[model samples]
Target chain A: MPSLKTLIPAIAASVLLAGTATAGDLVSYKVVDYGIPSSLTGKAGDAAAGEKTFVNRKLGNCLACHQVTKLSAHPFHGEIGPSLDGVAERYEEPQLRLQVVNAKEINPDTIMPAFYRTEGLHRVLKNFKGKPVLTAEQVEDVVAYLKTLK
Target chain B: MKTNWNRITLIAAACAVCVGVFATSANATDWGPYQVDDRRSGYTYMTDESRAMQVDSFQNPGMIWVEQGADLWNETNGKAGKSCASCHGDATESMKGVAARYPVYDEKAKKLQNVETRINTCLEKNMQAEPYKWESKEMLSMTTFINNQSLGMPVDVKIDGAAAEWYEKGKAFYYERRGQLDMACKHCHEDNAGGIIRANTLSQGQANGFPTYRLKWQKVGSLHRRFRGCNKQVRSAPFGNGSDEYLALELYVKWRGRGLPVETPAVRN
Candidate 1:
């Protein structure tokens, strides 16, 4: 077993991390730097699960505003945003993740919604306050799926 | 003539200074001709098949509401035993060009009032009847009846002096973002006028076809009724029909369709 001196620091570190989550104030999200994070919550996301989220209208619904020609069955994909068929070849993984997390950080007027940010939004219902449109895990999953588009 | 143009420019520039113009207001005030009189029937982005139905008077579904309106126009309903026809003789003559100048500034009321208000005023004062509820079928029938007389006439609402303040308010309202969707009216109607969102193709959202027939509702509806529907789509709470906000919006959008012909009982998706 670990000694008391070592256990004290370990317990404090876990408590600090736990407090960051628990749906804290959305203002805290400003700490999410403009560029990429070193890792996506330190989890290895399943690509298969991420692909399902990409196509589901209730989830990511990216297909609503973009055309991904790779999905043969999805018809009449929107032409508003550019096609994302070979996006992985055009952008690095970190850049793609930034755009997915919050495109408005780059272009303030882009109609593309911020899928994983939790600040400066209107009418986020009571139960959903401080909650990003998708959870942190979902964001990681989507990023993994997007990296496969090449 | 040069002096008249200069005077108008002075008024417009003054308006800009007073109101602090919004960015989306420019798009609301400046748009080229929307394709009308063709298959699209003013809503240029809707399907050609829907447009075909609007042009064919016999097959036009809105004609049913027009026919219903015609019946209500001549019927007696108030406590005074008076009908719209009792004082205003033949509608074909008395109501000509009336709908074209609607949402006028009422001097006594000190506010902007549209055709719906005018109809209700007559309903209560002239006929001594209870005022019709907003968006009610009876109100729609009367409004459609009166406006149908001005069919094919170009929209020519006069927006000068007192009307100018309301017009600016309407423009501001058009560009203001609301609801969880955070969408301004100009985004869908003005910016993406020809773009497809989901199954429907967006149009310039002109009000010339109001008291329009929408297949979605399978009924004739007022412009304010459509306003409520649009607000709900954006997840915003809509105010009461004929509310000041909606009336101001009506005036502004009417100016947007300035030269377009009125197509009351206009068929829409």
Candidate 2:
């Protein structure tokens, strides 16, 4: 059995880790030439789950400003942003990853929200202050889903 | 996977009851920072049933509070022993065209003031009465009653003079990115008006129908209240009601509908 001193530190370390997770601390990555060339979770995402997030209003809500021709059964795709049809054919996976993570990096004037960024935002509500709108895994999932457009 | 898609489609259909997918007027008119020529009131975006309620005075829920305001206008309750009616006389004659041009830059206050702020100013300075709370039933009733007098009149507010600086600030506020969403007012209301966001149809977000009876709230609410709600929805800490930010925004938004007729106590979903 471990000593109390050792046990206490172990418990404290886990508590600290849990707090960080709950606060939605971002998984850091490097952007090389406007693209993140790594998997956020170091594993491939499920394209099927990504499709659900694309449509869920309370989730990614990409359909709010994007149109996916394959998802036409879902009504009222917005026209403000360009349509997402054949997007994968135009860009590779790394570029898609960066776009989902933070489109503002590519286009400063773009109205698209940074789904995986938390810093430098204004007047964020108390509960949402440190949290990115989508989790890093969700961002990967969205990128994975975007790849299926081809 | 197929079942999940089916469920989402079902939910989308349910939302359609409140959100009509019809396109807005095709005429594109150029306005400051916007090219939407199809200026339709928020009323144009509401469901048919909600619009019907606004047309029938008997069935309109907001008329209930307006009737109460008629009584409050006459009952004297202040150190001055005066009522809004005592000085303004019959609101029908004294208040017409007043609400239509409000959120006006008050030279005395040195700031813009909406009908709610104006009402509170009167109660404190003129009547020597405790001002009504910003969202109180009495305040909503009074503003609704006052604005009803100006119903169908064009919204005509001045942005020239000292008001011009504040108008610029309000315009900046409308375009600046805000909250966790990083969206400006223009993202939805300007760029995507008449488009669906989930199940809700985005309107031009005009200020014509204010102190409106919203089915979502199940009661009449002031424009400031709606502003706070929109801020919160974008995951931003909302400014307080009657704050300078909202007062300036009111001026800017009311100016956006400069030619649309006022639809006070308007019904909305």
Candidate 3:
């Protein structure tokens, strides 16, 4: 498996090849460089509460394909995805927020569903029309918990 | 000598009884959940009345696309000024049993072709019109309209000959790991089937009743889209729409649900 460091150059090359107009692109690299407010800055959140949110189906549901320790009661924890052992050390809080909110923004071809950007992306359930799967507050909480991984 | 003969006869009778018991247990085991018994027919939750209701409610946003397909069938396009109806006639009659045999090996192309690809080919070659983009609303509608005509037929994706290669490719892809997260399809669908993934019970991830009306989606969608969704959930970089990997996986899924009746628009949670 290629490390994220190795994959970044290839991803950058592909982005260049796709001819994306960075000026209008929200959360684009240009915007990141231009010092737009990153999605990560917020009040500190409880990791214990966030841990509950991670395993809760109504919330994060992170254990579906990921194996996370300290949450063993949740059945059907999948091993298809990697174990989240040292994720905080790999990515900063803002990058983590971007990934959780919408991974495709970073990689246009990502399979990871946009937890925050529900509009125009998700096939809306009739009852939950216009509602995101995760709210901004919940994302912040999860991000807070993730930052403590190290 | 007579006592010895009597004892041998008793032992033979006991052996026969044991064989009968074993056969009965085996038959019972075959009917249990997760056993893909050839003798038993596939089961579904939708009833005849419910299915009729769903069909009648074609006014739904999802079915609106199908209605567009109904119009497209008769409308003329391309320089030839010929409509799809010109050759296929009434789709209800012409397209019956067509969906069941799809994703078949195309001898000319020397590859597997699904219903959508074949339809595009017909549009380009026969009608002389531009082909619809794969996974476009127009294409989905057209394909759904055609597939709806073949409801109740058994799925018959051929797995022999050159088509076998595609099936194997699909199987390998399903088991292979990828993405930053590094997971495979079987880790959930097979290994943890019926187990709880948070609140929802993990289905075997069968694709027999596709273009299903999912509670989460609140609309009917194709199996390919579902495959894409699963990959996304696992944090893998997704294959592009209509990519060969997705197509191969679709073929494998269809084969997995072989012998199950085509549920063109099933409701699922």
TM-score of 2: 0.80
Best candidate according to lDDT: 2
Inter-residue clash pairs, candidate 2: B29-B37
Cα RMSD (Å) between model 3 and the true structure?
Answer: 13.2
Using DockQ, give the best candidate's number: 2
C-alpha lDDT (0 to 100) for residue B28 of candidate 2: 31
User: Highest TM-score: which candidate?
Assistant: 2
Q: Which 10 successive residues of model 3 chain B have the least lDDT summed?
A: B38-47
TM-score of chain B of each: 0.83, 0.86, 0.77
lDDT of each: 0.75, 0.84, 0.67
| DockQ scores of all models, one per candidate | 0.23, 0.41, 0.06
Residue-by-residue lDDT tens digits, candidate 2, A9-123: 9976765654112234787676777787888899988899999988898779999888888999998887667889999999999889988888888998777888888887888
* Model 3 C-alpha lDDT per residue in residues A28-92, reported as the tens digit of each score: 32224222234433466567777777778767878876776756666777654467768889887
Model 1 clash pairs are: none
What docking grade does candidate 3 earn?
incorrect
**Which 10 residues in a row give candidate 2 chain B its minimum summed lDDT?**
B27-36
